[model samples]
Target chain A: MSCGSSPFGALADDTRRAVLSLLSEHGELTVTQIAEQFTHIGRTAVSMQLRVLRDAGLVKERRAGKYRYYSLRVEPVHEVISFLNSLYGASLDGLARAAEASADQEPAAASDAPDPTGTDKDTPRWGISY
Target chain B: MGNLVLSQQRHLALPPADVFALLGSDRTAGWLFGADYQALRVGALVQFELPLNPDDPNGSTVDAFGRIASLTPPHRLVIDQQSPWVGRLICTLTPVSGGRGTVVRLGVEVPEDAVTWLLRQRGYDPLEEPTPPATVRIGVLTSKSGPASVFAAATENLARMAAAEVNADGGVAGTGHKVHVVLRDDASKPEVGAVQFRRMVAVEGCRAVVTNVTSEVFDAVAPLARRLGALLIYTPVNEGGRFRPGVMRLGERPRGQLRLALPTLVREAGGKRCYLVGNDYVWPRTTNRVARAEIERIGGVVVGEQYRALGTTRFDDLIEDIAAAGADLIVSTFVGSDEARFERQSYAAGLRDTTRTLSLAFDESTREFTGDDAARGVWTTFNYFQELGSDGNTAFLRRYRATFGATAPPLSSITESVYEAIHMLAASGALNTDANLTELVSAVRAQRFSPTWPSAQPEQRRTGEKALYLAESIPGGFRISAN
Candidate 1:
């Protein structure tokens, strides 16, 4: 299925968000399985949501004999996630470089030393692990 | 039981046997933080290779191990972990009605910090972050239908008023979070109350639940509170039991109220023969047991005793038996509308002319429902009465009438306890921080409610608060005894 023009439209509904979270928690689930988790809504309504997600390329549908299974497709949101990762990564790199440059310019100046996370003064604290 | 617990539940559209198959599959490692093992037998080892960074596919991993402590096929599984995530993990699967699905309950007995770390690794925020104040939601569960609905008449109004008052006074102590109250109706049934109680905690995110339902509901939801890591505060007179951690049964016990009311009632009646009548339930049965002991100690003879179904309206036969037994005093443990019906029927039978009745659950709303003619000369015991002559009570009554209008359901000990419970939670400051069970109990013990609230003092150990005043019903309201 094509991701249509805008993926944001498909993410606007509350049920779709919850469906996405459930799909993320469990890698894959059948249409009936998803419907069971949400007793408040019917099977037809869940199928409609899955169809919406499939149309938006947010989830992949697989057919096995008489049953159908659905799983979250990370491709549509992968672009946005990679962009955010780069944004944070670039900011951290720039901060570390700036601190290293300042430390090198004033090697003997105690005030200009970068605050290292470890005991070694050479290691900068700006590397992203989170 | 461990020092901390992390619990989650999911409804699967599969039977318990199928769910057990899924649990034994390798796919579970996806949600269980990379804990991989397909062995379903007891004493099998499971190794955890949890990702250090969930967002990065090639990030370093942390290693831990656990062994299967017990494995009950298609039902329960227990695993004992070592080191970093040191505790036990329990999984239970139960088949739902109609044989269409199963409900899976998972609990991890680990420290709070370790759970927080695990959540963070799973791409979630830290569990104990207090920055950027959150609105503390408290759930109020009261009966709006069925037999005991009358007891909850003022519960919702009083709880909302207390929430508004707490917010106006700068929210819970030390936290700037505004107070939010989520009201739910239990329908006076234990099963419905348990469902609503779970919804309030799991779905609505209520930090603590203040219940104005019967003790039957309390028994149903007490275990759920511990499993869900939320507080259950019950507000009603009860036969106190060995309540579990994370549950605060803040209601008065029947023993204390009986000790205060039976003596005066017996002395005024000028007889030692007493009859006991109540609805069939744990609270009623427990109260009767205490009454039996108290009556014997006070030199009284047990004349006749009987229990009726909760919503039974026909008391003619019971009243006839009570009159035939020649009892001078009667102890009525009937609750809500049942209590009112018994009083009115007894009055109609002319049993009230010679016999004195001491009702354990009678309050202003019930007396109003019973009317002045039938309720007059009836004795009751409680920690609060709207007719209390105190400046704090006067101000409270003024605000209550102004907020709910003059025709609102009259406040009684049962309803007043709901208001006091919210303030008690605020006083303990348990809403702001992740306080442990001991810290919570001690913090609550150190608190004394305002003069407007009841003077009942919470016990040092397990039992709830206790302070009783004997009152007699008059034309308009009740006259609380000086003692």
Candidate 2:
């Protein structure tokens, strides 16, 4: 898991992901309150993880007096989701175009549609399937 | 000195008219210079004799004279002097708010070439020769990023300020060269520090380099500096160690700091049993030995001791152990963010309620990182503090604030020492004369120049008799308490 360059790299850790999840559920929490939720790890460790999350833009902090409040930033997560959707959506569009072209060129290309029932192949497949 | 400029200001409780009357009267003129002068008016020559020593009858006197350049009643007065040194003097008076008082400001501007002549006239040796080269280059190595970055803030700013001041006074003393500072960040890594050191010497042609970095990085850079035959002035408080010949250590020795602080800790703070904690390095380890020896000498026991790797953030177990040790004080030698982390965690663990902390390396910059409450009541010893009350320090602080504004990084001993070292180097004729590394080192060691801030005593060897002030952490910073 990377913690230097990419924001997603910060969420790759179980503890950091857990921290983001907690912040997402709770809206905002101080370092002490967040540390209290985890008994196994020390506060310093949590603070360090929070620092990494903060550096990666996964969490934003607000200071009230001496206390610092950390909250989950959804913009980074939304950007990641949009990025992944674009990647898969492009490939799915290409596949749909290829299937349509094959049907238009080869009217009897019944295997391309993969009929589940043999009776569908006996009729005009396009009209029957529709 | 011909190039010397003296600017002084005072806020008087009297009104502007009264202040102006006093300044213009012959009585005040006699007090300023021991003779009556012509009435204050434009184009009038004012002459007076200044006795070298007023108490001694056999002492010599110098004829000081000036021409009144401009006169604006109850507002501004300008005088141009050419006798002892070629300079210009200006005085201003402005009314204070509510018609209550007046603000008086006096300024003196002299050329740099006449500074040596003026010093000679005053029976003092000039810091440098009368002529200086066209330009000179100095190198600075500091951490701009990494774990040590917290302590490295304002290192470059202070060095630049020193260089700018020197250049403004007409370059280096004899060479007449403008001082140029080449700054490079070590990234708080040993190898990177070595590389930067080599680049500064071999590439930048710097004869001397000042380092404000960790002992680890300093140790790595020291050998390279020696091999290159360049002068290294180390400016961080470190564990006392054996160094090369041309290298000068300006930081306080751990033995000296703890020697002065431990006895007071045991007596005033009632700290008998102490817990030792620090980063596992030469500085902390060596300093801890000094602390332990001092504690034992003072009839105190070392209840517990622990070391963490550099950059270690987890301090829960250590705090728990310290609390369980039943010690009255925690002697920590941690540096930078590690110190802040340890202090904050210790406070959270409730150890601070019963225990007092005496850190070897805690400074103003470090206190900013550790929240006010987390670091409250913690004690540290240093030669300089930002809030020190002295005329020289007051002027220095005023100039620094005016230059960098209020949001500048807090002034710590490390950065201040860098400023001192640069000025000391210039005073030693390193930049003014064509001396090699060994000769320059010898010259620097021989001269006893007064630092800008008041040290315990004048500097003799590479180390000086520093009056360490023990301070307790307050809300914004450390407050020097009664020793």
Candidate 3:
């Protein structure tokens, strides 16, 4: 299968992502050559990993001397860069959510203190100071 | 470059195998903990609360966590540790190797905030006059307040006693180095502990810190020690399984404890049906994981195990479940206040009527807190106690009673191990003058340290050459069992 515009997240697994590192570290290694870095696994496993990286546009491949050589095409990291930007936004949004949660819990706590009148302080804020 | 990403960034030339190898390096793990000593390194994620508290034991107690931002190379690591306490935090690691060994000093500069600059107060001189290169400084970053305050009291005394003994005799191998200890309070919080540790190294000129508080606190300090190029002496929950190079763990590693205790427990129970309980967290989580594995390995069955939330005050529901398990033994790891609560409640639930309990954490202080009546019939195991051994123990007990008052520091297992950590470190530090962290580390690794061991080999069989001994609760204190 080929990587679509929205398939960026699918390429995040170790096998797919590590392909670039393997190629870059060794410089233009064949599927077999790249597989040497991950020798604990089988050669076909390495080829499948390389396929994912090629689909992600994170690796460039060519047939040389009857063997397939894969090189790093790091241009796709720009998409990863955007994904990381989104991650930062999500993290900040999480912080904001946490802030709102604490803010909401505060009045519930304060209202239980008992108002000056005979009413319970936390009697559902129908009116607001703001 | 390889995956040797222990520093922030890679040189882009190292291979993954080399990087992975470095990851497993003790030297690498040492720098991973703290970056306090040198000017700083690139991608050096040292946790520094710049604006620190001078009087408080732990420096600006910031709950710090972060990822390595950028590894610049050669002598600098820029760690991106952002926390509530730090608006901007950068730890710079620079090697200041005066001679053969590198003096990695971590310089933490706060360019953005003044709320966090708790360096040594100007003109205060947090450290003493510089001694020669051969001297060794060990600080006790203890807690006088907070949850761990009780344990810290004995640990501080223990460390001091060990230093006193080392200095009184000929200091380590005629290195002629005097052992000095500085006490700082962690308030039982890791943030506080990390900060205090930073200040102790940066200001007080300490090279090592010894503690056995918690995995949370230990984790916090461990990373910081790497940043500072100092060593942390740990008496971890499972003795010292986490014993890396710069990090040295002394007693009863959880694996070692189980290796010894589980088999004995199975033999004593006459079968493998076991009930386990812990104050649900790191210590118990690890203990149960190892326990379950051991039980399966030994062809035993774990009937019931309950891990309660930390700070849980009651264990009635858990005990009820434990009682229903029909198990022969109850294994536990409840520490501090929860320990007492668990014991008293377990006794109240009448679980003891059917089950024989074996504890991994109860000791003299725990019994004192829970009342011996409630703690009675509970069998506890540990590495050391004042009651365990001979002339050394008698002298230690006499001095401890005299120092803390007869009723205080009743020689609990945790405190005794911590006390022994100090004695061992001081003894090794004095003998070692290679003056490198690794040398002192090797010395500690080579030393057999059970300050309270009686007749057994320096290492007990149960905790694997640990002073780990078992005793059943009596009316007064624990009695070291012959079994």
Candidate 4:
């Protein structure tokens, strides 16, 4: 399953997003780990929702005997990162300036990075050390 | 000593009207000296070394160092400085009639410094010389107040001292006239600089104009100098690309300077990704674009970039977001006043040690404003030293302290340019020996000033080259890394 492809996939519920957020932050979580904050819904509903998350590729599940845990998938994580990047396209501009002070204008001249600890990093106008 | 004037040098007698136009050139306030200095005649070889602030020993930013080539006659001059930042300005001065007065039209050079530096640093060199009175007028159009005032303001005082000393000496031709600096406050706004530039010419009757500034402000005054028949001496650049024919830009361009700071930081943290932070303005945004282009070129990735408008003082949310991104480095471009607040907040948010900030335009003046704590270990670059171990710098500080009653902040290459502009003009003036615009213009094109040279002012000299210095914030204050 993919984002926006499920019958509930097209549905972007606040409760469902909260579940994904918890799983992402904590890596993998059991039903109890996810249900702790979703007091509005009981454990059974969260378990069912976890099943939905797994179906949408937004999460994955692993069973350790008595308990089952859910983890965020790298694909969806990458997708979210892309979305966030597009949303905040203007970040890093301020930060890149820190590097701008020293060799700020010189882009990489070749396919490789310059020696990270080379004292002559600034020797070439087109050289890059990072 | 104060009323000395020059006797003729080349046995040239001027017609009454032509002489009046030349002498009365003083009425044209703010006249800038360009390549074809109205005062410089044909066949003058100015043998002067480009004066730098002399601080770049740690591979820091190097700017505005070169040697004078030749001052040919009748609107043509050639220089031997190997600066890629300048596009080999083939300035041609043509004097025309404007509003019943003569106008000196000019042409200029605009090139990327990286290319120039690449050529020179890789063994590219130029050779030449001549001896003609290439009369020039040195003008300074620096911001005296407002946002960008701090960087270029001290340049005025340094120019004053430099000009005074240069003129008191035998002048450029070892003659008698002294140099006079026509100062104005740009208010750090392009519009204001534009208006002030006009006033400096129309009202002040300044022969030449000198200024260190951004493109916006340089754009405002570049054409006006041509119209009024003055020379335009450009000093210490913020960004490149503003070379008009009549304009002689004398400073390190942006790319050459930025090349000094990048690459090293990218590898220090061992991550291929970066986040950029800077003032949401042309300089920083352009810097971001270049960095990302460079990063991608090197196989590294730009994780992200962020910008805040000019006066933002908050960073809590921004810091949290950066930490979440897990970037190895967070680059910064926040200049002057904004720098302190950003660092304090970045540290408070637990992102300080996680990231290192490198800045441009945060010099000693900035350190004074931000204090030693907020900027500790924060690195920046320039061509002068407020904290370097140099006798020349020591003398500069002593004079400034005596004059202003307190030590002046670090004078960067731009500020030093201001000082050099004034003295160079005075030297040129010594040959013709006049105070008005035309002679002032001639005085500059013919003169040279150094950061550590000796003169009548006891504070200035004709040292040939200016060097770059790099310093980082340490305990007592910012210390020179390689010094």
lDDT of 1 by residue, B1-483 (tens): 114544545544445664465443433223242355535566554545433343443444333445577888878878765423345677777776454445556665554434333332222221122323468878898875456767654787788898888888888876657778876666567876776677677766776889968787778988998888787888788788995778777667788888888888988888989999999988998999999999999899999999998778789999999999999999999988788889989999999877999998898877866767889879998877888776667778888888865445678989988998888877677675354646665566555333222332222211343446789999889999934
- Say which candidate scores most in DockQ: 3
How close to the true structure is residue B180 of candidate 4, measured as C-alpha lDDT? 52
lDDT accuracy of residue B364 in candidate 4:
63
Q: What are the per-residue Cα lDDT tens digits for candidate 1 across A6-103?
A: 21111134467567667876889998999888968999999998887787567899899999989877564333333323322332232233333433
- Give the alpha carbon lDDT tens digit for every residue of A1-130 in model 3: 1122332111244454355545545668887766766747878998887776677566788887788777876454334234322322222222223323333445542233222111111111111111
Best by TM-score: 1
Task: Return whichever of 2 and 4 wins on lDDT.
Answer: 2
lDDT of 4 by residue, A1-130 (tens): 1123311121244467567656645778898978888868999999887787677566777889998878876554233223222211211111112222222223331112232211111110111121
Q: TM-score of chain B only, all predictions?
A: 0.69, 0.69, 0.65, 0.60
- Model 2's CAPRI class is incorrect
In model 1, pairs of residues that clash are none
Candidate 2 lDDT over residue span B1-483, tens digit each: 124344545444444565555543433222232233355766454543433333322344333445577889778877665343345667677675444344556565655533433322211211222223456677888865445766554676688888888778766655667777876666566866886687677655777888879998998988887788788899878776785887888787888888777876766557699999998878888988988898898889999999998767789989988888898988999888789879989988888778888998898877866767889968888877777776667777877878865445678887788887777676666653245888877766654333332231223322545667788899877888743
Model 4: CAPRI class: incorrect
Q: What is the descending lDDT order?
A: 1, 2, 3, 4
For candidate 1, the lDDT comes to 0.67
Candidate 4 residue-wise lDDT, B16-128, digit = tens: 13322322133221111211121243222111111111121122111121123344444444432222122222323333222111112122222332222222121121111
- Tens-digit lDDT track of model 3 for B186-283: 55557667766776776566777877666667777887776776778777455334545677766565666676677666666666788878875676
Selected candidate, larger DockQ, 2 vs 3: 3
